[model samples]
Target: MVAGLVLGDAWLWVAVEWSPPAYAPFYARGGFDALTATLLVAALVKAALLWLILRAPAPGPLDRRAKALRRLLYLAVAYNLVLWYAFALLPDAVDAAFQLALWTGIDVLYLLVIRWRSRMLRAAAGAMLAVELAGMVNELLDELDLRELGSGGVVGLGLTLGGVAATVITVVGQRRDGRWSRGTQAAGWLSAIVCALAIPLDILFGRISSGSLAFPVMIDAVGLVITVWHAATARELPAEGRPAELPPARQRVIRVAVAAAAVLPIIALIQPEQTPHLTYTGWSMDCYDRPSFGDLKPEERDAAFLCRARSTEGGVPPVFPDSLSDQQILAYGRALCRTEDRDERKTILTRAGSARPAWGVDPWDLVYVCPEIIGATYPELLRSTKETEAANAAYIAEKNARCRDPWPRTKGVVQASANYFLFVDGDTGYLVHDPGDEAADEVAEQATDKVYDDSALIGVAGSAVLIGHFEDVVDLCLTVKAFRTPPPQRTAGWDEVNEVPIVSRSGRLTVPEMGEGGDVGAGAPMPNLAIAGKGRYRLRVHVRVDDAGEEQHLVVVYPGASRKRLRLKP
Candidate 1:
């Protein structure tokens, strides 16, 4: 009882720090308000009784056999510690091996210990009983996570009953023989083994595993059974023969240590935000206003050039022209002739230039109109005729003329290369992209207008947040692409681009740009996107085809970055 009181105090501390605050007041004041004061008073009364019992206890040294048994108990404690450490460090198979060894070692130790001082078995059994009771309570609290509560409950009950039976048998044998009997001893050892097995069973089947109640359940069952049996059969020993009490200094130290251990968890529970912080880079672009092709701050213009140069050299070419000045690039788009071989390239550049009074079309608008022409195209350099180069020159001249100063300078600076472009049509619901297929032109065009009217339905462009830094952007891109393919199909050869979860709410999560069959189903709350470190990221909409029925395209947009989507299956 004294050990339990001390252990309870320690547990109370852990509960305060780790458990939900909804139960805080229950622990603080013993229950809801003064009406529950009786509980606290009862506990205090019990503590007083136990203290009195201890004061009245004084017994002489045990026989040689009893001394040997006590030494075995110490050995059992050492074995348990070693087993715990081994379990922590080894793999499952090794851990299991060590666990079995520990269990057998402990059983042998207990058998030896009981031969000399059978009364100690009762104390051990009582402890086990307390543990079992605690386990039951924990299981109830975490029932939602358990797979088969009925089976788990049956096993728990059986183990508890077995411990009780073992305790009873041990007491009966001790009374009949003036010492512990082999049958009682066998039952006790078997019960201990059953309790050990129960730990793994609970872990595999229970809902929650932390601060587990399994150990408590086993200990309490054994403890109560043995204590009851001994009390009924054994007489009290003479005071002179009782075990010696700890010195005042040692007792004080233990009490203080226990009290501190109990209080720390309460402090931790009050403040949990200190655990850790995570951040990521984000990016975004706006194309609603006219494209001020050359209108950039000196520094920004220089940075754009650097970005373009770096892009071309680093494998992925810049989406826009890097060789020409921003002004020249914009002007060149306006100068292109419709009949030239490079007419397609000229048209793309012209549309990307400053916005016109009628330029309500978004960047996606241009992509939709010229899907095949928008993405990277090889400028055919057949040396024999220089045919492609001559044609491109003519097209560039015509593009420069038509793209000239389409939007006024008063509207604010136009971004040359934001890395992302958005296109929205007020009525057509059409959308297009730089890297989209020519075969999907009609679908892209229809999606453009839908972008504005039903942005919420469109997954790719939903409340976009930019994650800054190229590496993170690439990773986000890859994660997003992963959602498009099934687990079995995903491999090194699979598409590198994948969709990632961008929005999460109550019971639903959504990702951008998944194929038609990839729906984010409603369920318990989904996991958030965890960008492990500091950086920036931009969330935006993009276009994707409907695999089920290409004719019925949908737009999906989310409110914020909190939306959840299907996890990367692989």
Candidate 2:
């Protein structure tokens, strides 16, 4: 009877876990319809097998064992189906924990039903009972309040030791118990073996991971086979004056109960895995309402990109609190794009540009406004920004260090265009460069001995601020990008540029962090005066360094330069 019950449960677990239909409302909603149908069909097959087992002959009216077996079979069937259904409805992590608990519950019940038999079986059952109860308790405790008995912990270690001990004792006891049938002795030993194997398998596969189903079901199947073999061939024991059958009326009640147990689970199988009327809340709804993420929808892809951008902060990518839907995420991206304070422009462009052709969203869709600056979908653009910023940062660091030390002068000619030129030494500092063009009509000058003082430079459309540092007469120059006209006003054909002198000086300029796109310091890659463009023009800056006893003064030489061209296009 115990064997049949364990076998039935084993069958229940295999049927439900192998390829059972998914319940509704999973990440892929209704994705398990076919599998759900498969589970229903499997249930029908198991029900038929149970009927066959019931027809097998029994000796000496073993009513107690028979009753226990039927109840176990009913519980197994109901719980397996309920667990799968619940797993589909719950989050994956939550469902996994619940299934593990259910597995433990079923195992405990099995031990309780069969523990009264042999001394060896009782010992094995007691050990298992302790393990299961302890596991449950540990799971309920908080990590800070009390350490959980994880697979590697003391409680799990103890269970493993206990399982081994039980297996050894069972085998030794069976060898000594000469009067018991070999089959019965073997049965006790085999059950102990299953108990011993359970600890390692649980540890290896994890308590609720998918593969965990393999060992427990295997143990139950082995138990079932042994039970069937014992029932088929073993000699009958003394009747002990127990009635061969229950009283006639009581017999009828037993029959009814058995039939109901067999039939109820089969009926329960017909419940729909998910209902159309089901309502979800919080993250569940988020997943449910998400539009399909397929290559056909460019807007949806952009939305996904936007969602990733907005969700990420301070270099961390956004986590899926719950999987967001296509439409919902796209709506979020669209709303963000409309905001003026939005600083994800480079991030959007780079991510879009790097996307492969297989991805439906066109990079052009995100950066059509500034084609030249943004670079239309070139993957190289992604690394170019970083390389440029790194170069700038190294240049600033080196020049500042040089001014502090007044190091030996090293000169190298660096190329400069009308817009930007910086003397960059991988070893030294970075400086913005512009040689004096004789055509300029006005010149402004400043002299400062203290650090962090400003030098003003006049341009056609606007003026720029330059901060200088003096270390015992040596000078350092820093240019701050001045944006007098907003981005909207500065477009193609608009001639405006701020020129700084080409000289060896140590000065630092702060640019926005890369991909952050926010205001300076909010993120990297913020616009600097050096990055701005204008028509061909030049300005000459001369610096005279003189030493005081303990301090230094830097006098700026603003030689007249030209605004020969009205505009330069970038």
Candidate 3:
């Protein structure tokens, strides 16, 4: 009965007092919440009690009737034990490798406890049988199987296999040894029949806590022990005859009580938990815990999701954030977005230099990707202080060792204005059109294109050019240089390499009439790059996103002409 009380305590606490989200602090490692560990201490206490029971002196051999009643207790205990095991393995793996190890340990413990109690080879064999007798019946009730035990199927199967094998063997061996008892076999089968009530109760009770059922069973268990003791000790009890010797009404009452004690906890154990153990697997910019994700591989589901959590799954994303700290980066992004002036925006984003933490998003990419944080009420959110400056000085010393190189960048934007190669939809590279080519307008209408679309490396989706990105809002280092002839080819240090056509119809490398892109540079002063005249030209764009996510774009526009799309590397 004390053992029953201890087991009941865990269910009661979880059903009433335990809040999975409230305890998230204890379990959420990175984005993972290992809910199974929540009940570890309780399980240990239960194990301790069992250990004590195993060490305690054996009671005298039971007469047939007493042994039959005891078997019912064991039967209830068995059902509850398996239910507990199912629950223990309910939550999906937090760390797949670690969870697999835990699975082994927990399963072994389940078998050991059952076998130690039965102390027979048959008991050891029964440890593998899962509690499928009730589960198969679960299909008939609502047509839904034990999804409650999602992903825990293997664990349950192990238990059911072990339990059935051990029980069957134990019965056969005991009978062969001339020591088999009909009472014990009857108890197990009867307990199973009682356990089946879990289905109807599940339907009727709907979504209530297991406590509703467990507490009652605990009460019944206490009453049964007391009543049976009183009956046994009565001064004028019959020496033999089982229930035939007792009053009919009392016998019926005892039978009912035994049934109640056997079924209630088993029913309670299968009751749904308030928060099912969740395993999230997918590419998410935020956290998600659902059953669907359980179908994905551990690595796929466990990929670092940061930025912000979203309810809907995302499309092929530009980048999936891996870091947890985005507060400062968001503040910086908002500051850059205060005005539409492109230059000013760049100034604000890169103002902090090493003083600002990249937080896994380059400031340029933030202007497009994290557009939600732009145009905030608080623009100058986190201005640097004297202390921060000193700290940044220390930080830059280490950061610059690898980030000091410059490339042919946004140098003297010869013609930041694009009359011929206009700002198309998804394409952002230099483009040229024949006398009246409407390819730009036609493709622009297909998808919402971001100018600085940081979709990993630059990709050609329709007409838009997608670019790769830095880890965070790190400042870019650029050195734009013009070339009359094609620049010498350098094969290394480029993350993306693509070529786009730049048309100069009247033969002059001056700012052309670039159609309004409705983007950041709308109100900004234009900078012009002049390094050519007349005829067609091609801009070979070489991009580098460093280890820390800082970006550098090398633009070398030389005299050339091509209508075909060309992409060498990205």
Candidate 4:
């Protein structure tokens, strides 16, 4: 009856773990999906302990006969546990801690066997038991009310029963008894060997060899038949005295084995490093496969990304918080994009984000992690709805009216260097618009620095002495904008608004026609300064972009450099 019960539970574990009921809301929610696999391994370990008890002579100084076998079983279980957790992906705290505890306890128990007569073994054994109990309790709490129970047993029930069996049987195996203890010992050791050998085959070859977990399951089936034999035979091995100590050379080998076990995992963690996982509060976006990232719609992008990021054979990418739907993912993506503070931009956040300095938002992963989802999805968001379109359109027109000239059309995004803010302020690129009709970089160097930041979102259009000493190349669109009685400022909605003093030696000058190339030129292939003849004119240059700024800054030119850079709007 006992053998049959063990056989049934073993089948339950393999069946449920291999094909988890992921349709259930709580299934695979955390590490819960692999609960059955953990249980299966536990059952095999327990069976090993049973075999050790039933088929061996009474314990005395941890027999030399199976010492090597014990070490092999331990190594196998350790490897299998590591892989199982890897398969689980985002294991919770309890799952990780429990596995660690189980590993430590098994090692400690093995150590006890090697030097069983050592007075220190008693304390080490107690410590192992304590660690196991704590692990059991931690797991029990994690699964409380989370996992539902039925025939196979899972979550709290499976783990709890395994814990109980480990505690009770392990205690039973410690005794020096007659016939019964011998059979229990034999059963226990055999079960461990079965598990040590079978699980890895199941994981490594099960699917490829038989297209299922037939490898491990069959090994388990063979284990059950042996159990039946053990039950019927009822062995009576005689108790024996403590065996002689293992040779010093053999002991040295055992110590080296233990040291290798400890060093291997640390090396693995060090090489490429362990991949970290993030548990999102709501949405899960991890898929990155796409033809063109920016082209896909937000929903489609989200449909592509999510789940601490793992590949599935078919269907949707596994949602991290699995309850999320396609539409909800979109809604969540929108919410994240729209989360720009109505009050302030993420300036401090940039400072706090990463130690590496950057002019853009790459260090902080609000959108860079998933481009399709929240990154490019909201580019046209201001005009997405009819009301938003009308309101944003009117607002843009009102802002642009400040610029006196037609909005300069930007050709493309120009890569800015580390001193981009310096260029934005007019130190490098503008002074005398050389009537020779080139932006005279030589003359612009004489202009004073007048860069100041207001941290304002939408500031008024308007600046002076906007010397254009640009690095042999300046995008005309950035230099000129719709300047009203004041000029239009292009803040790009998120970029900082800065103004600095600019001086022009003469009004009649030329600026480069900057484009997507590495060509060298001084000004716009060149624009008429329209500046009623430039001589000793003060210019406060505002380099900014708004959502509707058409990717161009509103360069408002005024007369006379300010004592300092001025804030154009409240």
Candidate 5:
């Protein structure tokens, strides 16, 4: 019967290996492969040994009950193999369902087999069946995502209750039988109790893999111990109860087959690899480009200084005085604001602000004020500053208020202020002026290098170029800013740097126009820009144009380290 069980187990292994996602070792490695193959081989060898054992003469006559039970065990093993094969051929959903059913059936059969076979085997098998049932139940629950009762929680409770009940029953039955010395019965009961106690601990804290065949493994271990003890102490069964035994040669052959079956799946998993295709789209830019302040000519410095002053005044456009050249403006801005390293700043002043706003303040003033506000709100904003409990509470309250009513009517004023400060901080290349005085030159240099390495300027062809508008540029800029400053950590005060203005290229429809259009940018307001520290992050942009009779476009961008892009469709 052991041989037959082993052979059936081997067939089960063959079934699992043939199923997809293709068991290439490159994809699936470690214990998953090892255990799978081991089980397979063990099953095959056991079957071969059983056949040989059946061919050998029995030690003595057997009772009808014993013979009947043996036949049923063989039949159950056969049925299990058929079910396994069917599972392999079915679709994934169907196969999963079938496997679940099959395991449940196997558990029932195992319990019956143990009861009719040997007391020790029965106990071992019963324990294993309980564990397997617990695992299966847990797995099924997980697949359904019934979070109220998690798989681990349910399995743990079930195993604890079942193990205790089984142990109690076994103890009562053993005591009644009086088949062994009192000491032996005591030891058996003690072992059973120990196993019962271990079940809950293992379920709660054991590093056991969730939904794995841990119960079966425990049962197997216990079964082995019981089998060895029985063989050592008990002589052959009484003449009427004696069962058939495997021949020496068949037993050896079975062992060899089982070993081979166990190893095959693992070998299959170690196979080769394959290549996959990838794609990307949308506007991406780097924020660190520091202009050289030291080499700036006197006239250029004058222009930059004037631009900084005007930017701080709040309403003046990003323009320098007529007396200073573009170079001076660039240099002065870099020196005053520490943002000279970022090319975007240069571009914004030189090209975007060519017309210049009459009331806008200089960029340097905006940069200085921005950091001060951040620092004041969260003192820990300063580099290396430890957060105090009072500060943390104040920060949380501020953040909650901001989140609840994020959009203020004074957005234009705030943006103007931010732009002015940015201009002044260009040269220092640091976001804020700190007492430590660690220059942001390194960050600036790295940011500049990344921009040059990854970006390219491409002109749009035909009439489509006309579609681009000032609002689009503004949206893109805001998006870039948001990406540069990710959301603050939970323990830290809320920083508004994550907020980015969402703008429509046409300017006809503001964010309030979202979902009103059936055009290119319909539905909810899109998040056109995003900022993240590390790991995969998403940026969603939605735009709507009423002129086109309800047209909208939704753009989704996935950005990763090294500036990799993945564009998802809406």
Candidate 6:
């Protein structure tokens, strides 16, 4: 009984933990509370039933009437066991309803024919045997994947199979000797064998934790020991004598005790939990205990999810391939995002010194796909200030010698002005049309068309002369760039140094319109005199209109990083 109590409590704990979300309503309504209460009641009831069996004098060899009575006893016990298993293991409400109805209906039939004991026993035995066989077959079909057997079916199958074995063994023992003592020995052996087999199979199946099975197994084993003890002490009677019944007072006491046991479980079922959330019988603790992410505190759950997002394998562009595992990607991504290296920032810039798609991909993509590359391309990012600057020199040289050219470079832009904008990539000049002005649109079209007409300008492969709204088109250029010339200098006003605003967010150079009277000195040459070859320069200079209706030079020279010392003009 002590062993039974411990096992039962453990099983109840596990069942509550593994209970599914769908069973939340039931839990709120005290379904699990009822199950726990009933398991205790069942232990008590079974002990009393066994004591009654043991105390009765052994009946003489069975006449048809005695055989029928023994069969009825087996069926009644089997029916109860099957229902108990159903309630314990099945998560679905429908399955529980079916099993409950079956159990109650059988009991009702048994009561109807109670006066005609032989007929009632025969009828009940047939019904229970048929039920057990059907359940066994269903389980077999489901295990083979030929049918969909749910949680209820699984528990019902195990219980019925074990009950059938016990019943058959008892019947055989009774046939050999009419003594009820022999039947107790049969029960003991059957219980031992069934429970031993059941534990291993439950583990192999991987439904719930194997440890949880120990409770049910131990309880059955305890019952088996009790049966064996009773069998050893029982005495057989004369052939003509009937089995002895309990005294009236003892019978009345047993009846009252049984009633109390039944009532307790029913009351437990009706009583609702005070504070209920959705937690119920459907949750599986074993799932949370898996190797990669087990035993996580509530706070650690978000970290686990972050790890998953960075671990995507092949996609439309293969965001992050399976070449990297989730843990590796997550660790590297976090490292790069926290990096503080200036050179690491430049590694994201295009050969033209424009930062757009970082290293041929987005910054987010870098963190996910090739974090090691970010570290490799900019080693200073991961090092402390005291580390030698040349520490990565050899590694960089070795890698550059063998690494394939990271090609298909792309560039993007940001613009400050709402009017016109212009960008020159290689020999191709992109013009942004001010959609609100018909004259500006014509000028943009003419400028774009001139790119193809001029022979000196070497057109970059697949570079089309683009013309669209300043904000909608040229403002956000994510397309691949042909690495040729450095991107044009950008500024807010006249005074500045070489500033690297994130190129994706920095404005394209603003192109102001020419005055009504066009003439020499009408356009100003931006004074960053460094030119690429003899290609015809597609200038997009800002021109200031004077009162005379003539556009004059609006020269602006924003400063940049240079090694040479400059002579200051006084």
- The TM-scores of all predictions, comma-separated, are 0.22, 0.29, 0.25, 0.26, 0.25, 0.24
Model 6, 94-162: lDDT tens per residue? 454454455344334333422323554555555555555455455455545565444665676565564
On a 0 to 1 TM-score scale, where does candidate 1 land against the true structure?
0.22
The sequence of per-residue lDDT tens digits that candidate 5 reaches over residues 1-570 is 244235443334334332222333322333343355434444444444334333322254545544444444344344333455655676555554544675565456434432233677566657755665565565555555555234355556675566556545544544444433333244345445455646554553322222234233323323222222122112222223223444677456644544433443234323122211101001101112222233344344343333343331434333444334434444545443434345545554554334443333334333333335434544343332123444544543453232221222212211111110112212211111011213334432433344333222111111011112112221111111122332222212211111111212221111111122122221223222322322333323333333423222222223323222322211
Overall lDDT per candidate, in order of appearance: 0.32, 0.35, 0.38, 0.37, 0.34, 0.36
Q: Total clashing residue pairs per candidate? A: 116, 23, 52, 85, 74, 11
Tens digits of per-residue lDDT, candidate 4, 279-339, equal 2222323343322334446554344433322223255333223334334444443444454
Model 2 global lDDT (CA atoms, 0 to 1):
0.35
Q: What tens digits encode model 2's per-residue C-alpha lDDT throughout 113-215?
A: 3324476666665675566556545554532346666645776677556545644543443344332344334444544554565566556443222222223
lDDT of 3 at 466: 31
| Deviation of model 2 at 256, angstroms | 30
Candidate 1 ranges with C-alpha deviation above 4 Å? 1-72, 79-91, 104-240, 272-570
Better of 2 and 3 by TM-score: 2
Worst-scoring 10-residue span by lDDT in model 5? 275-284
Residues 183-256 of candidate 1: C-alpha lDDT, one tens digit per residue: 22333344444445445545543222112332232232232222222221221222222224557874564354
Point out where model 4 deviates above 4 Å: 1-116, 145-211, 219-570
Q: Please give the range of 10 consecutive residues that has the lowest summed lDDT in model 6.
A: 498-507
Winner by TM-score between candidate 6 and candidate 4:
4
Give per-residue lDDT, candidate 1, residue 387: 52
